[model samples]
Target: MKYALKRIFMLVLTMVIVSFLTFLAFELISGDPAEAMLGTEATPERLAALREELGLNRPFLVRYASWLAGFVSGDLGVSLRYRQPVWDLIAPKLEITLCLCLASFVLITAVSIPLAIWSYRWTGTVFEAVRTAFNQLCMAVPPFFTGILMTYLFGIVLRLFVPGDFPDLHTRFGEAMVHLFFAAVCLGIPRTAMTVRMMRSTVISEMQKAYVRTAISRGNDRHAVLTRHVLKNSLTSAITFLGQTMAELIGGSVVVEQVFGIPGLGRLLVYSISTRDYPVVQTVVVILAFWVVLAGTLADLINQQVDPRLRLGGAA
Candidate 1:
């Protein structure tokens, strides 16, 4: 409980820093929100009024303090684009993004673990070369490129799935699943390649340890040696990578979401950024930062439980 509290406190501190940096970066940008909102035809009086309304006329520190206070109170401010509460704009989309990220994560983990196991089991030969080649190809490509290729081949050319919108999972479960199936595959490919490579390397290295040889010499089967010992010792880095991958999911899925026209947080983020919707952008960035911190905390806790050595490895 005490450790958890400490982790939570650190997360709060990190969020504060993230919020400050986000606000500062946006403020440093050249464009004025009022000008962006009202266009070139905006009069001086109209711009002044808009600034005052949005609290943009206030000093930077004052605006920051107010923004922080409101954020702590669950008020993320009003969106200039939608003229609605930014929190409301994001709330429904949040679940969609969470589902997508989670689905991608699941795909990555599922594919990576099995691939790693297989590669380790089938080391040294043409099959291993094939496995390595596949992983390398997947890892070499970017997510955006993958998304575009998938969309062109699947959506534009073949017309296999709808082009855009939050897929209707309730009624069109199979179709929705198929759409996300491709999206998850694209999102997971690079991540899975990286993860499988890391796990395979780690497992191979762990297998070289003295205890592994002792177990093998004792007539332990391959499965027992791999699962009971090698995997247990090798998964620490994998868990850490999984945590980092969770953080990357938000940003990496942007291209995938845009290609699919999915109403996930990534798409919303791109929209907000393009429109210079400060409240929405700020809220989303802060939320993403909180998620990253949360992922790291959870990973640390889980790793500590699974491997006692991790307790002394510092909170990452």
Candidate 2:
């Protein structure tokens, strides 16, 4: 209970810091948002009036406090570009990003974990060598490159899915997933390479530990030992590794989303940034930061459960 509480507190603190830094960084950016909004008509008096209306003329701390308060109360403010409630705009876009990320994560975990276990058993064999080389090549390939290739081969040549057919998940969940699956594949492949490699190495290393040797000396079957003890123990590192990689997954999905023309948070963020729509950009960034922090927290809790040594008041 205490450990979970500690993690929850840290999560909230991390979010507060993230929100503050997000606001502060935008405040520090060179351009004037009000000027950008007004454009050619942004004369001195007009710009000042617009800034005051948007509360941009207020002291930095006061504005941040007001924004933060509104944020906590679920009022994320309005989008300067869309001229709509930020929540209304983000709510739909967020569904797409979340579905993409979730699908990619599922693909990564489904492939990587089993591949790692299989490769661990075949270490130094011809198959292992080929698998390692394949993963290395995949890792070398950037997400955008992979996305382009996938788009060409699947979208253009095979016509497996349309490049810009990202349907609204809310209205067409089935059809939407068909298009999202391809985009997710492009986003997940490189990350799957990293995860598989990490899992294989960690399992191999765990097999050489003193505890494994002790279990073997107690007459446990080698296969049983590796399956029940070694793999379970080794997944701790892989889980932590995957958790850390969640940020990359999100970042990479941004590029993949563009290549595939998915209307995800990444695409929205790019559009928002280009249009000087600070509210939308900041909201997307803050939401992403929250996911990263939550992933880390979940990884920690799982690690504690996996290894008794990590549990509070448990074996050292």
Best by lDDT: 2
Give the per-residue Cα lDDT of candidate 1 at 169: 60
lDDT of 1 by residue, 6-117 (tens): 7778888888999999889878973898888999998999999998888788899999999999998988899989999988999877877777788899999887888899
* Steric clashes per prediction: 0, 0
lDDT of 1: 0.85
Instruction: Give lDDT per model, in order.
Output: 0.85, 0.86
lDDT (C-alpha) at residue 16 in model 1: 90
In the range 1-316, model 2's lDDT, one tens digit per residue, is 5777788899999999999999999889837887888887668999898888888878999989999998888889888887798989998878888888888998998899988888887887899888888999989988788888888898899987788877778787887898888888888888899898888888878888999989999999978898889988988898888888776678778888899989888888898988989998888889989999999998888888888777764234
Error of model 2, residue 267, in angstroms: 1.1
Off by over 4 Å in 1: 152-160, 168-175, 312-316
Estimate the TM-score of every prediction. Answer: 0.89, 0.94
Candidate 2: regions farther than 4 A off: 43-45, 313-316
